[model samples]
Target: MDNIAGSKSSLTWAVHISVALLVALWLFPTVGLFVSSFRTADQIATSGWWSSLSEQESQNPFIRVSGDQVQEGDLYVIEGQLFPETDAEVSAWGTSSREPEAYEPGAVVDLGDGQSLMVNEAGAFRMTSETDMEGTRLPRVFTTATTPPEFTLENYEQVLGGGNGTDSMAQAFISTLTVTIPATVIPIVVAAFAAYALAWMDFPGRALLVAFVVGLLVVPLQLALIPLLKLHLGIGIGKGYLGVWLAHTGFGLPLAIYLLRNYMVGLPRDIIENARVDGATEFQIFTKIILPLSFPALASFAIFQFLWTWNDLLVAKVFLIDATGQTTVMTAKIIELLGTRGGNWEILATAAFVSIIVPLIVFFAMQKYLVRGLLAGSVK
Candidate 1:
């Protein structure tokens, strides 16, 4: 008992540490991307998100005067370019919504010949001259020593609002769903029927057929893309949703049938035999007894096929083209964004997170069945 308790304690500690590390690993980049997505382009370029919580530095441009000095209550005013001479690269800045940057806490600037000026980082400036100079305008610049935290949601708005210069993934997301849903559902429906027949309907060469389907699983999907696409075009189904659906259904069927068959064959022989004796048709047995028992397998396969079809870019690219580019799916659109707006990390992060939402939903919905399905109709 003591040994078992000690082992359990060690296991608990290990699991806790492992989970903490995993959470940190996952959260670090995701949080950075989330914060970066909400910031301006220049802010993202200049500072890390960790710095956004504190003060920052910035700059401003202004003007100065010459040949006049004005004294306010015994303070000599001297003013010139506090900012850099030219538009050079800024080194650092502070961040605070109030006061921003206060140089000498409200001191005055004295220009040569008795002119003076003062300004805060809030674009507020002051100037005085003992006597007016000949020139009409004086030039000056103010450098910002600091600023405060800033954020924006413009990146997400552009991605979802359908007006970011290109066709937004809003349409592509729906298009992917249109392709993925049916692609996942059809194969499972058809493969379930096929799996049932292969498992229970004793027929000639059944062994050979199962072997063939199993063999197909090892065949790389890339090997068949060109040939299958040629067949699609030859059949006049070229480059459309229907063609892509059929392609994915075909690709997903082998494993679907194999997995469903294994699960189905494990069903209790006596139950099937009793159903056969009770005058229930094969269809009746399948629908009533097998399907409910097979929920886990079906749910598991649904998750796989759904995720694969949802995330597919290469297949959608080849088989779903159209004249108006209306058929492009989210994956393809994201790839296009990577090529076109490669520098925009906000857009990239938004696209990635958007693409993941559906898969995450599907996983959560079906996760209970994933393990249950694998063990379905087996123990009994």
Candidate 2:
């Protein structure tokens, strides 16, 4: 008994550790991206997002002291604040580039010509000379300061159309929505009808049709892109939302039908047969009985199709986007940003996070249904 209890305790610990590790593996990058989206370009460049949450010593660029001289008791004084916001604590200061942290904060440094400079911990500096200061170019000061963690919404603002609205993904976001909603909805509607027929109605060659759909699931979607594109062009649809919607519906239909049909097949046939025997029309039975009972399956397929359409770049590029680039979706916009604003981590992170937010919302909202449908449809 003692040995068995010890083994059980060890097994429980192993399971807990494995779960924790898996959660961290999945969460680390997502949390990093979320943190990076709020950071400034400078902050992202200088340090990692994980380190951004704590105060860290950083070498600041040369900050020039204003040449504007104030007269004080026959001495010329040049005073200025190095950091406007004073959010950082100055640890050291220097007058030359070679020795950026030559002097500690609050210590005065002499410049040999009856000139001296002092910088306090608050980043306030005062430079005084016996003679009037010369030249329009001000003396540069460097400092090592400990900056607190900082976050900004400017990246989000820029990506969402705040600055100039030129590089914004707002239009693409709308365009993606335009593509995803209909593509997700139409496929589920069509597939639900077809699925009900395949599951319940004993039509001729129904088994062959079901087998064909299941076979199509293994077929690669890439092989169909060019052929479908030609077909669309030949049919006067050309390249637009209509073409993309149809393409997504075609690609998504097989899985949707398969999932919903299997789920509906497993459902108690007595309820459906009873409805049929009670003088109910086929449409009425499907609408009132099958539709309500198949909510989990419908929701599962909706989430699947929604996410697939939302994240799809190749299909959108091939079928929807044109030379005008006006109908570009969020995924394609991120690709454009990869080429154009590649160096801008904040922009990339914000764009990526924005693209994922909708799918995540859909998943969380319908997760229960998704799990239910999977469990219900699983082979017992």
The number of the candidate with the highest lDDT is: 2
Please give, for residues 49-164, the per-residue lDDT of candidate 2 as tens digits: 88988886788888888847889999999888888874889999898999998999999888878888999998999999998787745568998998888889989889897576
What C-alpha lDDT does candidate 1 achieve relative to the native structure? 0.74
Model 2 alpha-carbon miss at residue 19, Å: 2.2
Q: Go through the candidates in order and give the C-alpha RMSD of each one to the true structure.
A: 7.0, 2.5
- Badly placed stretches (over 4 Å) of model 1 are 1-15, 50-52, 55-117, 121-147, 165-167, 371-380
Residue 78 alpha-carbon offset, candidate 1, angstroms: 20
Q: Number of the top candidate by TM-score? A: 2
Candidate 1 per-residue lDDT over residues 1-380, each given as its tens digit: 33685588878788899999999999898788767777766566667777878766544333333434445665434343343323233332222234334345245655566665565544344566565434555634444545456677777788878675483778888898899989999999999999999999999999999989888877888887889889999999988999999989989998799889988998889999999999999999999999898887888888878888998888888778676788888888888889988987778777777887778787777778665655542323
lDDT of 2 at 5: 59
Error of 2 at 165 (Å): 3.3
Whole-model Cα lDDT of every candidate shown, in order: 0.74, 0.89
Look at candidate 1 and tell me the lDDT of residue 182.
93
Worst 10 residues of 2 by lDDT: 371-380
